[model samples]
Target chain A: MKKLINQPEDAVKEELEGVAAAHGDRLRVHTAPNYIVRADAPVHGKVALVSGGGSGHEPMHGGFVGLGMLDAACPGEVFTSPTPDQVLEAAKAVNGGAGVLLIVKNYSGDVMNFEMAAELAEDEGIEVEQVVIDDDVAVKDSLYTAGRRGVGATVLAEKICGAAAEQRWPLPDVAGLCRKVNANARSMGVALTSCTVPTAGKPTFELADDEIELGIGIHGEPGRERRKLAPAHAIVETLATAVVKDLPFGRGDEVLAFVNGMGGTPLMELYVVYNELHTLLEGWGIAIGRNLIGSYMTSLDMAGCSITLLRLDDELTAFWDAPVNTTGLRWGV
Target chain B: MRDTVTQGGLTAWLRAFAAAVARDREELTDLDAAIGDADHGSNMDRGMQAVVGKLGGLSPDEAGVGVGALLKTVGMTLVSTVGGAAGPLYGSLFLDMGKAAGEDAELTVAQWATAVEAGVRGVQARGKAELGDKTMIDALAPAAEALSAAAACGLSLADALRRTAEAAAQGMKATTPLVARKGRASYLGERSAGHQDPGATSSWLLMQAAAEALASDAPPDRPRT
Candidate 1:
């Protein structure tokens, strides 16, 4: 309820306007059906990468649009999936004659809309390939739920695939690499506080001061379990253990350790979580080859952090090391 | 004794659906809060409001517009306006139904059955959800099947639609014990059980609206317990 914004309804529009103005050198923002495309898009002969989801995850699908990440991103209203039309338009704008790749998160709305968009694009004779990221280890894979929710690894996938696309990888190859990243990665998150969505004007869930929600998605939905709040080391241990065990990551495997903060969590706490994560992995003998530690993906003003570990081989490690420049992530340029 | 549904009846069904969603919006959001994000009611209400507004623009004369076109318009509107998984799923249902109805100003009971079945199939295809998944399909699939069976039995359109509503209500209630296999609710794992699926609840309300519009002489705004 207490946030810096002019109006609840105008939150997405105003935020997008700010993004366009600030990052105008690297991206172009389109309205009517809002979408952000790389400023230098239609890169001749290279496959285009498009990814989007609900808007509150700043710098994700949008801020990541630039030289080495997503070519276009369609942001929906806060905590809402973007419509198919937005996806289709973005695909049309960004396709460089090498086809287009849609990096979709595995939420039902996201998957359905992106799939519909892919069909619509194909109808218009645009070759479109899509890969769904379901890297969150918190959601159990069972007959009761829609598998795992895509979380931190989505950012990682975009980065790796974007690098591959920059290298002029074919649509299929880029899509294939995306799937590989999804397959090799696992993520888990814990929330210390609930987030307040603008329109709702209240917290999505009420968390007692002494409790934490474990295995939470980015939308402020309650996690798998609620437990007494614990120290940073214990929290990181739980998250890291779950992700590491889910991937069954081995002692000799090389990994990209990504410790991501959910918007409200400060970098200080994230580093604390990262410190525990690093020590935990080191004890397990898993080598951390490349690392990204920050709030790359976040829920709106929620205090939490997620750990994503991508099992990397020579090829994936190379892509991870490739140069990149975007608002949310930048290095190796 | 109506043996078929006319375009006016289809429009009435949508209006009743809008009313029902508006009435039950908070209930749906409360249900969603337990296992999923708490926005199903608000999102569906917003979409249905747009649908009713668009429906109001149509001429009252049945000859002016076919049921397919009207339903397709509703689908498109919902797809554009509704922001969550429910939007695309519900939109697909109506769009596929419209495709199945195809240019018909009036549809026989059997034709309506075919359209409902097609709509349910479209939802399944778009959501990739199966019968046991605790989604809208839990209600919609059974209602579609029951409609088809009732139609095949040579029942009147009113009776078939009423039976479909009953099946949908039963399916909606059935979701209380199941584990969700799709959508955000699935994130809760075993904890998701015991809460009725909000999508299924909305699907039941829509089916009830159809029955009220086509099966009974009851007014659209009549309260249902």
Candidate 2:
């Protein structure tokens, strides 16, 4: 396959080295393999927050690493998970007696790995708690369903959980908050084009010039269905409708909305999506308490977008508004 | 046909599998970029490399941790390290495998099969795209099904793996004419009908490695030239 790189195997390592070199001041490199932890991890007696997965979803787990987000992020090869050693090391390094909290998405691999880390930490008397966020509303639970997908909400979870950890709340409390965010949030996405894997040197799937996949997850998992391209407002309606049904928004409940772009899609498209979503929410009589618009979490350069909404309460609102100094989502101290 | 899968054999199997992924990462990724995310090869390669790194001093005391623990670690790593859909899909596979393997010091052949079955189920559950969707399930489902059938046939562990790999290869190839139903290619609707699925292709690599490295004794059919 033809692409810009010295060698296929060296791609991840080489790229990580570049990332470390660029963000070294704010992040520390993990030696077991390619991983990054916030420079201020452990923060004396503070609870540590660690989250990660594959590399292609840049500014995601890695970009979210900072004071209010992840204490450490173990970068796996492009679209791969980081190994246990890297996670274990991060756990140990970030542990400062107060315990650590793991924020994981709803995907099976992420859930399993984070759970394993918690077990290892407990083996060493380091208290650890984990919360898996399954917030996507696109795919329904069928006879072979694995529940909801974790889409745009992961960024919100990280930011809110990081805020909680920053407050030095006990592990259980912070973990609870992460779970709440997960439960309260829902996301749905769609894609227009397929992204080519760096190593594979081809698109993961084929997309006709005229069609699009709706209810797509960040990972390129199959969405609800494929149809000919439609207007921006129509797509927005489709995504929001699923989310609204899943969450069944209360009559006057406050909501936090996020319109996230899937890599290839530009701000222009996302803004168009956001405008449609805003109008739809208004029609539904749902009040938006907060909003995030951009590629907080993405699927390479796939041309698509996902919309996420969090049902906010006083506690969650406070946490959401708290300071998150990560590279991706940074605001409100 | 041994009824059990020894820890040593399992370890050897995993090590070899990890190495195989490391070796063919780019090829896998290249396949993925054709229809899905472009990072499968690199992502699996990265995850396997991490596994090798952690296996350096794996001790018996870690048994209470469960296969889920190791798999989960790999899953989390992938979520952060690897980008795109592969990280989550592969992560889910290992996560389910680890959950099934939980804290067991060693694995029986039946138990290993059960774990893989669980993992496969997990992938189907999470991704929602089925066997005909031209995703990894094309290869994975056939491998699991073949292994199950082989178990019933009372074949050796090696033979069972070989059969599974053979089935997986066939399944991978079966994707050529099917319209894409999952991942990015699903967007193509009718246009995606002719191309082979990248995820399914790499899924074959996983089974091929397992069959060759872990089940050499199986008298399974070889790929046709």
Candidate with top TM-score is: 1
- Candidate 2 chain B, which ten residues in sequence have the lowest lDDT sum? B216-225
Each model's lDDT comes to 0.88, 0.74
lDDT score, candidate 1, position A103: 93
Separate clash counts for every candidate: 5, 71
Q: DockQ, in order, for the candidates?
A: 0.60, 0.11
lDDT of 2 by residue, B83-182 (tens): 4466557767877887887776556667778888988998887677787877889999989988888877777777888889999989988998987756
Local lDDT at A90 for model 2: 83
Off by over 4 Å in 1: B58-65, B215-225
Residue B48 error, candidate 1, Å: 1.4
lDDT of model 1 at position B26: 99
